[model samples]
Target: MALLKGWRYGVFISGIVGLIGLAIYPVVIDPMLHTDKYKEVQKHNRAGVNQEAIQPGNMKVWSDPFGRK
Candidate 1:
């Protein structure tokens, strides 16, 4: 647009570049740099989920009280 010119154009272009970098950072850079750490965190999360899956209380969280599940 006419409003985007000179330094404004630089700012606009830089903003677009920043957005692209952000998208690529998560999808490409993170997997390349931190895949092992991410897998470890996922493993821990799954372990925690399985550990607390059968919550024991007056209100059951994941388990069926009548043993239907």
Candidate 2:
């Protein structure tokens, strides 16, 4: 009975560790490791919008919904 209980505890702790690893991997590890692909996707995702079209004025955010660029 004691040995069985110890294996259960070990399995539970290992599962918790695996969950924490999965959470950190995407946000931190993947970006640094695959920077070029990341940048390409980021640009593609922001296709229609101009981030700072007019720096000191009202045309800050512009978007054309129908166009990819």
Candidate 3:
């Protein structure tokens, strides 16, 4: 195995620390601050309503066709 020296080792160590921070941020910090906002958004939405919101023509650019356009 090759050995790292000086600033190269610092860079390598910092990269590993950054990756660990990223993983922890989502699993810990994000949920604490954003969970309520997520639930509020979910209140107006539903799963398995895929033909519309989750798919094509559910967007505002499409015509509704039933005079709702």
Top model number, TM-score: 2
Higher-ranked by TM-score: 1 or 3: 1
Backbone clash numbers for all candidates listed: 0, 0, 0
Locate the minimum summed-lDDT window of 10 residues in model 1: 60-69
Q: What's every prediction's RMSD, in angstroms?
A: 9.1, 8.3, 12.0
**What lDDT score is found at residue 34 in candidate 3?**
80
lDDT score for residue 68 of model 3: 31
Q: What is the lDDT of candidate 2?
A: 0.74
lDDT of 2 at 13: 88
Candidate 3, backbone clash total? 0
| 43: Cα error in model 2, Å | 3.4
Q: Residues 1-69, candidate 3: write the lDDT tens digits.
A: 889999999999999999999989988888667877666666566444544554555455433222332
Q: How accurate locally, in lDDT, is each candidate?
A: 0.70, 0.74, 0.69
Residue-wise C-alpha lDDT for candidate 2, range 1-69, written one tens digit per residue: 445367788898899999999999999889777877776787799888657854557644544433355
Could you estimate the TM-score for every candidate?
Answer: 0.49, 0.52, 0.48
